[model samples]
Each structure stands twice: as structure tokens, then as C-alpha cells.
Target: MNDYENMSDEQLVQLSLEDQDCFYYLMKRYDIKILRYIKRLTTISQEEAEDIIQEVFIKVYRNLNGFNRKLKFSSWIYRIAHNEIINQYRKTKLRLAMIPSNIEDQANLIDSINDTIEINGAYENLEKDERVRKALAELPDKYREILVLRYLEDKSYDEISDILRKPPGTVATQINRAKTSFKKIAGRHQLNTGIVK
Candidate 1:
């Protein structure tokens, strides 16, 4: 409904706190995006991902009154979701990013990774780019997260810092380190994947 859609996320937050029904609009706008982010960040199955998303939205609603006006709503919600993901990982040692978000350019980069794979033999299936998946999976958690936020979400350094609750300078350092680590992993595997830089 235009009435709901026309309102900014901050305005809707105020409305939702007063009337729970108003929250659905907020859910509708972010559910899928956050869902995809969940999957990309974790190896959770579709069902589990949905459960996490439900938890995320519930947290958002419960914390509605605490939402900060100085920050973007999207950033705030993402920070909550990221914390949830970290908590899930801590509790269950759940999976982290293994697949890129299916960006054509990223897919191309994944394919290039195949050439760099020092594995004994080529993966029979590249459809899911399993080799590429493994490479991403091998990355340290901090590195994997930075790459996903930067590339898949197309987020800026400040945005990523906000989501990760780190200083902007730290985020920048991690991103650089992530790229270097990614390259090192490729080197260890003897894959000649082109420069990720």
C-alpha cells in the first residue's frame, strides 16, 4: 500500500511501535534481501535461513523503540542480523560464506578460480562452482564477511563498519587483509586465478 510504502523506514518504525500491524511493511521491504544475505553468509539450509530471518525481524520489532535516528535503518537492522549470525556461529559453529551471490561478474571470477585450483583434478561440476565454493569457504571468517559485504551487498566501508560494529579504519584494514588472504589461499592451492585485486 502506498500509505505504508511512502513512509520512510524510520517513520514506519515509529508507527510499528504504536501499532504492530504497521511492521509488515518493514518486513516486506527487507525480508528477501536479508534472507539472501543470511544464505550467502551462512551455509544454513533454506528452512534454517527462514527461521533466522524470523528471529531477526522479531528482534527488530522488539527493539523498535531503541532504533537510532542517526543511522540508516537498513544499517541498524543489518547490524542486528550480523550479530545473530555470529551468535549462531558461536552456538553451533554453523557455516560461513561458501558461494558468491551469483553476480555474473563474480561468477566469472569464480570460474577463473578454477584455473588456479591446485587440486589433484578439476571438479566435474562447475554449475554450482564447487571449486569456487571451496575457495571461498577456506577464507577466514573475518575475511569472508568483508568480501561479501563489499561485493555482494555493494556496501561502503562505513556501512560495513556500522554493520560489523568496527571502526571504519579497521574495516578498511580488514578488507585489504581479506584480499591478501584470498590471494594467499589461491596461491597455496596452486591456482593461477587472476589477481583478485
Candidate 2:
């Protein structure tokens, strides 16, 4: 049994190219994260989302040699998933679903955003915060996606930049803008949330 868990993504990529069995480990590493990301972006049934995931994996396998070693493998994979979602929306006219599915993910996202925006006790009563949820779903795709990448996914600025194919400066600016937009929306919705600056 190979210590696939101990191997770096780059190492796994190389091994996967030579032995297709190694690719299974790579897919296992990313399946759930990518699925959640897809769900975050669109309101699709589980079967539909699984189909999209299969397509992403197939594309990743085909483009394995094109992977840029300079980028973290996770970032590269996410970029692929992002493009695939956009393509699916274009092809099928799927409605983008910015609201997270479950309360746990919603609370986690709120907690993470609080790390930057200083929301007071938002996570504690997240289940009751329909206004906050509405505010999030109302955000433009660019802002919502940026927030999901930065807060929910816990991606660093550089990682987000690579994943979104944007410059690092732009990534930082967008995150700031997203926080501001969320604050404004929260205010308009009369959310019982407290934001410190």
C-alpha cells in the first residue's frame, strides 16, 4: 500500500500520469470540497452536481500535463471547477445559488467572514438569521464568489488570485469590496447583526 496521504499533490500528479490508479487518490482528495464549491455556486440536484464533478475530474485528468507546477494543486483544481460551473450555467441556464445548503456551512461562513468584518455573535444565532441569508444571496456573483473563496474556502489572497485568474491586488480589493457590500446589504435588511467597521 502506497502512502498516498503523505505524498504532495505535485508528487501525486506525477505518479498519476504514469499509473492511472494513482489518479483515484487525487480525486478522493478533492471530491467533497469541489462538490461543496459547486453547490455554493448553483442550485442543482445532487445527481446533476455529481455529473458536473465527473466532468471536472475528466477534464483534470486530460489536462494533467498542463498543470502549472508553480500553482498549488488545490488552486488549480478549483479554477477548473469554477470554469466548469460557469460553462454549465451557460449551457443549461442553471440558476446560481449563493445561499449555502445547511446551517453548519452558513455558520462557518459567517464565522469566517467575522474574522475580517468583526460581526458580533452572528454565528450563534445563524439559524434564525434569514435576513443575513437573504443579504448574501442578493450579492452579485463576483462578490459572492469572492466571499466564498476567501471566507468559506479559507483560501489565502494569493491562492484566490490563482484560482480566479485575477491579480493578487485585485483579489485583495475585491475581498474588501465584498465585505463592504455585505455590510451595506446587512444594514438595508435591518439584520440584528453588529458589524464593527
Candidate 3:
């Protein structure tokens, strides 16, 4: 009967430490987001992604006492999930792929990229464009994951820096480089319907 929805992540962490049931709120909050993050970073099935998420939540709970309140909770949790994803890839040698399953999500990613790169597009029509998706998959793992974190996941530079454990300048540079790489790939795929600059 607690209004867990009204509580911030830090508060939930504190409560969860004292009352384990409160941990469910934290898991409930990030479960889907972390699952999608795993799926976006690799060609993993829902079952596999869910398994990774379970592991992520378990790690988060175990490390709750060590959670740095200075950092945003979302960033901290994502850092754990990112590490787990890397571990999974190392274990399974999964094909690295960025899977933006939702049409709206894909369009939002395209729009965000367009805004960041100053592309001259009002309508990208990327929802039905397999080439765009293919272009995304062709990017290097670093670039693809950065794009997902920046655009799709809507993480800020500092948040990304924390999640990736890179310097803020490094995250900014990687994001810029990722944008350039994506543009080049999109060009090769003839996806410049309204791209500019």
C-alpha cells in the first residue's frame, strides 16, 4: 500500500535496504528499460534479455549499500546492466546488433540524431526502412551502443560517462564520432532523403 511510485530512486534504495519488499519497486521501475537496453545492444531473445535483467537487479540489490548517492540512480543501474551485457556477449559471442523494435522508438532515435547532427529532415520514413536498421547494425559496437544510450535511452553526456565509465569529454567525442559514422553508413545505404550538413 506504499506509494512507491512517488518515491525517488535514492529513497527507494534506502527503504529497500531496511525493508526488502521495497526492492521490488526499484526492480519494477527499471525492469523494462534494462531489458530493452540489453535487447538493443545485442541480438538477444526476450527470455535471454529477461534473464540478464534478473541478474542485473540481483547485482543492484546486493550493491545497494555501496550505491553512490552522488551519481544518478539510473546511471548507476545502467552501468551495472552495461557491464552485464558485455559479460554476456563475451560468454556467448552473440552477434552485436542494435534492435530498435518499436517504430516510434526508431523514429525518435532518427529524430534525435537528426536534431543533433542538424539533418534537414521533417519526415524520415525510417519506420519501414530496413536500410536504416541495417546501417545501425553495421556500426561498430561502441558507436552503436553509444547511439542507443544517447538517443534511444535519452541519457545525458554525464550520465553516459558514468554508465560507460568514460570521461565526459570522451563520451561527447564518441557521440559525435558515432553520429558521423551513422551518417556515413546512411549515405552508403541511400538514406539521405532529407539529410544535410
Best by lDDT: 2
Consecutive 10-residue window with the lowest summed lDDT within model 1: 114-123
lDDT of 3: 0.82
Model 3 regions more than 4 Å off: 98-103, 118-128, 191-197
Clashing pairs in 3: none
Error of model 2, residue 17, in angstroms: 0.9
- What digit string (tens of lDDT, one per residue) describes model 3 on residues 1-197? 45899999999999999999999998999988888888777777888888889899999999999999999999999999999988888898765675565567667776676666543334346432566677776788898788889888989999999999999999999987887888888778766634343
1 against 2, candidate with superior lDDT = 2
Instruction: Evaluate residue 116 in candidate 2 and report its C-alpha lDDT on the 0 to 100 scale.
Output: 61
TM-score of 3: 0.86
Ranking by TM-score: 2, 3, 1
Clashing pairs in 1: 116-191, 116-192
lDDT of 1 at 11: 89
RMSD of each: 4.6, 2.5, 2.9
Per-residue CA lDDT of model 2 for 1-197, tens digit only, reads 36999999999999999999999999999999999999877889999999999999999999999999999999999999999999999999987877777677777776666666655444446443566778887788899898888878889999999999999999989888887888888777765444454
- Candidate 2 stretches greater than 4 Å from native: 119-128, 192-197
Using TM-score, give the best candidate's number: 2
